[model samples]
Target chain A: MKPPKTDSSDFILSVQNLNAWYHTTQVLQEISFDIQRHKVTALIGPSGCGKSTLIRCFNRMNDFIATFKLAGQILLEGQDLYDPAIDPVEVRLRVGMVFQKQNPFPKSIYENVAYGPRISGIRRRHQLDAIVEESLKRAALWDEVKDKLKANAYTLSGGQQQRLCIARTLAVEPEVLLLDEPCSALDPIATAKIEELILKLKDDYTVVIVTHNMQQAARVSDFTAFFYLGELVEFWATDKIFTVPKDPQTEAYITGKFG
Target chain B: MNSTRQIKMRLIRQKWGDQVFQTIAVIGVLIALTTLAALLIDALSDGLPRIDWKFLTSFPSRKPAKAGIFSALVGSLYLITLTALIAVPVGVAAAIYLEEYTSQNSRINRIIEVNIANLAGVPSIIYGLLGLEVFVRAMRLERSLLAGALTLALLILPIIIISAREAIRTVPNSIREAAYALGATRWQTIQDHVLPMAFPGILTGIILSVSRAIGETAPLIAIGALTYVAFLPDGLRSPFTALPIQIYNWVSRPQKGFHTNAAAGIVILLALTLLLNALAIFLRNHYQKKHS
Candidate 1:
């Protein structure tokens, strides 16, 4: 599908002056950005630059930490997620996350895919079977795994495990998908397969990906946001960020002068 | 040339030292095994003929051939049932709360952690005295089976908590994060993911603690359990006698026959503990295979 033309009206997630702290140390400093609906946005930065921390904030995953503190607002479809009335659990269901490491549960492959819908209170056997098959098909893993749905998930190779994780995320039919370097642990062939799936996913889901590989961001995303030391250095169209970045730091990073 | 000679000498010395350490370790194992073997042989020779249905069925008596351990067997069973019921749930719940729910870096959580570690090393007899004061006196449980069970429960509670925490900790942080990412609550994540992976380890701990409780004699003696209970305890509050007390009484008597009876009782106790340990090991292996 072609990239949606630039439009602020299509922004599905908006962060405004978001500041985050882990204990006494501040991590994300006054970060503000927008995630357009049905578009792939790639967050690119060196290690410890707060890209993962920023994306985790979208789902409030950092609330699990006692020392974690954040100020400012994260608005998902114009709703303030940090509002006391909004349950973090509810926020997570609507905005699913896939971790860097392939972490399939220690259960059968079918059960792993069905985990999200099961916890959301769907209990019928036949309905779960249909959801599991459809999700695996969308993830491009159905043909290889259709016969062995009863087998354990770890029996699959690393690449298959990563795709299985994506299928698990999609089974819940989330409005947005947050990926934290989802391909960092996989081989090249697995990486290509996942990129294809993520590109296909852009037609239906808002995708926010944090990646260290510059070429991957360029290949898959429509918008690119560069961060440095807890601050947003630049955010623009992927083409402009690659060719003529507005910030010198972004230019140096893209040109490989320094991290 | 001189430096090469020195290096050769140093290598030879290191090899010699390793052999010496290995010899010491083997000697230590042999010494322990020899003592254990002696005890087993003596118990078997004296007790094997006495292990019969009649020997198991009759109550204690003045006549040596007629006496049995019926009441003591029944009392021990009741005590363990009560102990398992009280200790397993409380110990496991405390473990879950500490491992999954609380932050390890927080001051209060750290303090609780250190205290639980210290409690595990505290002498079992100390727990007995505490149980005597708390359950038997303050709670007015008397010298009944309930008091004995509660005392043993306190004795093993620290063990259960420590093992359960270790088991829970073995589960990777990634699994928990995945569950939470799917919108599962903290309780749901623990019950579904953490507990299943940790069940085998927790069962191992419970087996070990219960076996230790069964062999314990001092705490029961300190709590004033009788040595010659003629009948089974009627209920929770009724007075009781256990296997250890009965054996102690028989061994202390002047009659040679009671000593034989004591050996026979020791054999029964050994069989009971082994049966329990085997059952627990079977369960742990079954779960580990299923998960791994």
Candidate 2:
């Protein structure tokens, strides 16, 4: 199979003037950015800065929150994702999410990967096996887990569990992957492995990550957006943003002058 | 030296207070256990001599000397099955809707929740009144097994719902998030992940409710359950008698032999409750082991 053509101009997702609220409190104020195809875009901020909320909006996970509401446009491949006609379920299928904590379903490793496909109407055993293998391999977990595909997911270590979550997301063949502080619950070594996997994953899927660690953003992302108090302070190439940002607040935040 | 001695005396007083409280707690627990043990022992001693195959399988007769609990036992079984079948689904569905689907901010939902909590605390006999009005008279299903089952179902619905909601609430938010992130729809996540995790808890609640329903005679009698059901009920429309009703009837009779028969029936009822409780415990332990 030939790889899909992805250039800088091929933006996979575009968000414009996205305002979000939690009950009466406005949590995200007119956040706007474009996610380029096959590139890693990291959203970095301090805690409670709406970094996670912004990413959750991409796939409409915030719909579950009773008080959560959003305004403005989120377009996937130039189509409005939040349009009334578009199903959040279908949007979630195309744009998969991995949470901060490693949350593998209470099932076997094989079943975890096969879950998405199974729900989406894939029933043939051989096809599901192939998808599971390919997804686990993509997440860099196939070799460690190959012999124990039938083992319970909880038996794996924290890092392995996070990777299993990734593999589970990948099994559905999503075009874009969202990671909400994927390494926040991991140790340094596990964080490094995930960072490495992120670099590799960008070659295939458009990756958007939320992280509190500035170094992680610098290490893995191509583009980085800095958020402060529900506002997007600045967004630019990762190297440029870290070295010489346009905004003074971004500079202070990145330099540890203030949050 | 004087100040130091005073401080020591104060410390001794505090220690004595702590000991008093601890002793009270221990005594309270022992008192409860003793009461329970006495009840069990008394029932066994009184009922053991009367417990025979003939006592179990034979029906009640005009003479207290020849009475048994066959009709009552069969009726209790039927009532329990029907009660479980009706109450479990309605209670679980209400609980899931309240916990997962409905918004907490809505007034109607809040009212429903409050009513359920109040219902759990209401006297069982009060429920009998409601049953008489709704199931027997309003529905016009008087003096039948259906009315009795419906009445029992209403009595236990609140308990099952409250317990089930608690169980569903204890499931971690992370599990739901994991399922949702995988593109599983709300129903799918509930069906595939949440419900399975909550199953053991729901089963436990159902077992407890069913046990309570089995021992209840007031509500059944209020709905006009017959005391002398000589033959087995062929359908839900037939009049029925349960174990508690039989015990009540026997105990009211003016004969020592009838009193002994009632004691025997009480022992059987207690045994049935203990067995159900044991099954609930086993299910909980099995679920914990499998999940952990």
Candidate 3:
């Protein structure tokens, strides 16, 4: 495999003229943007406006939908993600995703965290334990779960389950962590914890989050991309997007005029 | 004020309709259970008298008083074990393929799914004929226990596969997303997450389907399984006699004693079915409890 040549050292992901469709109906039309390294970029948009769809494109998660089709390039570290030579599985490895719903496997909390490492061929008990502990600590869940790592993941509360899911993703040590409305299902206190975890995670990983809550976007994101009607309405520094959005639609959405 | 009366009248009518539906649903369940209970009582009164150790241990004899279900019982146990060996993996695999690997958007996958559902509805005797043509005549597995097992496996396969698919389908998409997001291949995701979660449902199907297999007489007869075998099957190639076939033979005899023996045999069959069901339920509940 040839190494992808890069123009910008700061950008870890670059989307160019990316258009996606479900069969004949296009949902993402000519979307293009660059996400910088080690920064949290938030994708905010109204429901059914392609916030989830756009993030799914990063890990090629939409390929399971038989009718899903996309044209354009999603470059990860400068390599074309859609290239036949580049397996989607490998892309997913480098760019791990945490879904909006907290979906831990029916396995134990320990097993859940170790699942990725095990698949990647880490077998020693000590090594797995170390990884699980380190990952859970990073997600700020080690204290609650460490004593009963063998317990079923479902035994955890909703917030804890979401944190367990985050730990599970982190165990894989991905370069980019994608959260699709991670706190939408969580309560205010749990949301605060996750938001803090996301801020901490950006020190080591490039973070992409999709949130419906505008306050959340303002609080956590360094950069914000506002999408409307399957189009990128505005993208700017988070403070600027919240304070003085160039697009009137962006202004209306943030001001709670109409979503 | 007149419109408010009309609205109140409409609400009262809707509540009455809901009560009618609720009663109908309860009555439907009661009818099904009562019929099953009536049959069980009749069978018990007729058979429970003849269920001594001698009747269970003795082989089929020309004399009705001397006849027993020993060989048939052994043959059935053997057949069931072999059928499970062949059916469960194959059925579960086909289910996984349809549910996890292939999307229903493809014509062939949809066709296969539709056909499996149709096959579940097809008469067991038709599957026996299929086994006769394919395994017995073509493959030359002549009247052997393996041939009988293959036939029964085919008969119950659609049921197992359809239920397995339903079981697999109940595994939410979010679980799959978690595995896939961990960079798992499709096989890894299914093997690691999907199958385990779907197992309780699959086990329930297997228990119900295998019970159906045990009670089947026509299919085995159609496939040429022996009605009366004095000895246990020597191996997979040996001719076999199942409980249903043995019961059929006794029930057909003109002797009043043989009919009583037939009833006794039905008790053994019922007990065996319950045992099988209990074992399946035990395993299913055990796994479900541990996982949760």
Candidate 4:
């Protein structure tokens, strides 16, 4: 592991010259970005614009697909993640992901939250209990779910399930959290709560979110990246990206000219 | 035509077709049930009186009029155990590999899959021939219990594999992703999440396949399983006769008593199959309720 540079502003992750493909079809092209520590960065784009693909690349989740391939250098705290010596499993632990759909395991609520910690070798009941409680609290779900920790996670509402998934990711104490359209499947109220949770989560974890809701990107993210046709069209402070984007495509998308 | 008249005509036509199809389907179901009921009634009427403990426990005698199915019953049990031991692991493992590890597009995997499907449809006697050549004569095991079990194992292996693959395939992809996201390795995900979720279905399939294996006579007969064994098989190496083989022998005999014994054996076989099927249903329902 490379030590953080003292002279530099802390960037938890940096992507350089990233290109990804599914078989012969290129899905991402030469994408580059920096994720600052303890801040929320939103990737905003239309569907099929590679937002999900970009987020999946952070933890190497694309490896599960048979045709998935990538050429890139992803640096985590100045360490090259794609190095042969670096395990994708270790990378995933450090960079946790919440999916678009609320997929809590069919297990109990406590088991769902404790799954990551358990797999990472935490076995004692008290230790697991603490991790589960702390993670649920961090995700703002503990109070709602505390009494029924033994209940099946699937019994929860969509919003609660999504939060449980978030808690599950948080239990492993990841440094960076990647969420790919986490609010898409949620109701408006659930979306609002999750957006608030995302904003709050940035105080402790570097959070990267992909959202189709432009107002959401403007409301929550400190910085925003706009993508089009698998390329990074523009990246700037959230206020600037919404108000005065340098790229015409970004302006057009935000103004609802075309997605 | 007026719009109302046109709409009425269309509705009548649709209703007529629906009624015709529904009636056809109902008739088909009734026919199947009637056949099953008739067969059960005939078997019971012929076999019920001869189902005394003596008939169930005694061995076949020199007189065709006094034969019993004890040796056959014990032989079937031994054959089932050996077949289960050999077939279950191999079949389920093949299913897991095909469903979880192999890509659908690979030529070699496709070839293997196609061959398995084809093998499932092949006559049971062909498997007996293979077993005869491979496990019995070539390996010099003779017409022993082991040979019969191996033949039955091969006869049922394809069905078990097909059913197990279906079971494993029914597990949601989301569950797999959830495990993977938790930093669980492929093998860990399969062992911890996938297998547990698929187990009830796999068990149901295995039980059904085993029931079919239990009633199989052609493969055993082809493998030269003795029909009139006077003693129970002591080991896999010993000569054996299964329920179907003994039933076949009794039914073939000219005496009325042996024919009655065959019917009694059929009743026992049917009862055992029904028990296994009930267990499968119970397991499936239990798992479904838990998961749901």
Worst 10 residues of 3 chain A by lDDT: A1-10
* TM-score on alpha carbons, each prediction: 0.96, 0.96, 0.94, 0.96
Candidate 3 RMSD computed on C-alpha atoms after optimal superposition onto the true structure: 3.4
lDDT of each: 0.91, 0.91, 0.91, 0.89
For residues A10-119, what per-residue lDDT tens digits would candidate 1 score against the true structure?
A: 89998888999998999999888888999899999889999999999989899988899999998999999999999999999999999999999999999999999999
All candidates: CA RMSD in angstroms? 2.5, 3.3, 3.4, 2.6
Q: A1-259 in candidate 4: lDDT tens per residue?
A: 1222235477889988899889999989998878789889999988889989999888888877888888989999999988999988898889999998888877899988888988889899999999999999999999999999999998999999999999999998989999988988989999999999998999889999999999899999988999898988888878887898888889999999987
Task: Give stretches of model 1 more than 4 Å off.
Answer: A1-8, B1-7
Per-residue C-alpha lDDT of model 2 across residues A74-107, encoded as one tens digit per residue: 9999999999999989999999999999999888
| Candidate 3 C-alpha lDDT tens digits along A133-197 | 99999999999988999998889999999999999999999999999999888999999999999
Question: Model 2: runs farther than 4 Å from truth?
Answer: A1-7, B1-14
* Candidate 1 colliding pairs: none
Count of clashing residue pairs in every prediction:
0, 0, 0, 0
Q: Name the lDDT of candidate 3.
A: 0.91
**Candidate 3, residue A145: lDDT:** 84
Model 2: per-residue Cα lDDT over B1-292, one tens digit each: 5699899999999999999999999999999999999998998999988999999998888787798999999999999999999999999999999999998678999899899999998888887888899988999988888999998999999999999998898778899988887889889999998888888888899999899999998898787789997899999889899999999999999999999999999999999999999999999889977765
For residue A106, give model 3's deviation from the true position in Å. 1.6
| Pairs of residues at least 3 apart in sequence or in different chains that clash in candidate 3 | none
Best first by TM-score, ranked? 4, 2, 1, 3
lDDT of 3 by residue, B1-292 (tens): 5698899999999999999999999999999999989978888888889889988888899998899999999999999989988999999998998888887779999888789899999998998999999999999999999999999999899999999999999989998989999999999998888888898989999988898899999889998999879899999999999999999999999999999899989989999999989988998899889766
